[model samples]
Target: MSGSDGSGPAGRDHPFDAAVALKPADTGDGTYTGATHPAYANMVGPYGGITAATLLEAVQCHPERLGVPVSLTVNYAGPVADGEFTVSARPSRTNRSTQHWSLELTQDGRVITTATAVYAARRDTWADTEATMPDVPEPEAVPVTPMPDEVQWAKNYEMRFLDGALPALEGAPESPDSTTMLWVRDAPARPLDFPALASLCDVFYPRVFLRRGQAMPAGTISLTVYFHADEAVLADHGTRPVLARARSNRFGRSYFDQSACLWGTGGELLATTHQLVYFKG
Candidate 1:
């Protein structure tokens, strides 16, 4: 797998895989251990998306996992320190067709993250999508947005903005509303998977940044993702870039809510996510 600094065998394993890799710990308590990958590091910690993926990975790797993920909610309780952390996942309840999981990530005995996940055996059922994908130019038509060198995690994805790109760091006019529409895929072109989809749900730059027209201190307090695509749908999407749109509903008291949708190349609604973010001037 590609290691930090982007040095590793090409086409062997993508950086996204390395970032979310977990090892089974010998504790025999169904726990896994993982370290932060420098390639995904943020200013104060590893990227929240990668952390969320790692937590979900723990459950996905579990021997007793019931079915594919239907929903996931991750709460960032505290900053994860830059070293090894342990994660544990347990099924709180299991029904004939669905299972509920509780997960936690800890560093030095301190709980840094907590999550809940729902997995279910899907069956054929009537379905309809009330939400429609927005009309936008194809990914080939949009130019790739250059990521800032310092933003390590941003480098992991190829982003092409259709609108609401980040504003200049200085003297940029504020936007009337926070909305970003883009096409994004893993930089090295990994296949679309649940963990990858979970990470992409967070690919949008904080809504506050787009609204204020400048960078600010902000972090996700909680994020929830609803998976609409099944394994077959994701596999069919392959490495194609996904159309994503994110916008904020309100911003006040140093907090904002962001909601987003990810659509497959075939116009299938792959996932929808909502997050609460905390920010500081």
Candidate 2:
């Protein structure tokens, strides 16, 4: 689904995907607006940024740079209820090492949020280091997990809960801190390039970390993922697992920070992430 209003005045599909609308004029003033859905807001992260990135990559000197997302910064300027949403973007600057894109997501005449992203310019340097993969559980061997809540975004990837998953929805442990692990693979049915892989990798924030108590819900407002390497730990599409470990840093009313590790089955550190979030009940 894209972003647009709930009304099905014309062509429509997923209600939450409606709010987002795109201006193709490249008026140097390109824009995308989307509708919002209550269910999609909590379920999906920010599709506008994602769609914008995908659009930005189209014109980039680089051919379809959709692999890993090195960093993503999002500002939640206002409430974004589900309906139809739109995103717009253009090249902010260009260079060899990295490319920058300025993007915005809006609904109707109003702006829902804004985003910025950075992508690697050359062949990945991280993969140069040689290391053994982790010896985690066989991804398929582990029990399959059903998606959570009516969260539509969760369906974007294939997830296998290693531990601390089923109980997460009820709120975290009674203590102050905790950790959870999951084996995740994205777009499993379809082959994904490096950039899209990184984007999806960073997409699951907020709920990525394990926490204690119900006093407040601290989730990521911004996240950065550094891909150390691109070695495939899992060759079979049937099942593949990447270890996702979550831990919190400082906690506050307005914001907090946390870190996560995404590892290969061979226990190799594939990617590292740090997130800043809005924390409050």
Tell me each candidate's TM-score: 0.95, 0.65
Candidate 2, residues 180-242: lDDT per residue as tens digits?
Answer: 567776533433333344444444445424454333344445555565644343233123456
Off by over 4 Å in 2: 1-69, 123-135, 166-176, 194-199, 202-210, 213-219, 227-239, 264-270
lDDT of each: 0.91, 0.51
lDDT of 1: 0.91
lDDT of 1 by residue, 182-279 (tens): 99999979888899999999998888887888899999999999999999998899999999999999999989999999999778999999999999
Alpha-carbon deviation at 248 in model 1, angstroms: 0.5
Candidate that scores best on lDDT: 1
RMSD (Å) per prediction: 3.3, 7.0
- Clashing pairs counted in every model: 0, 61
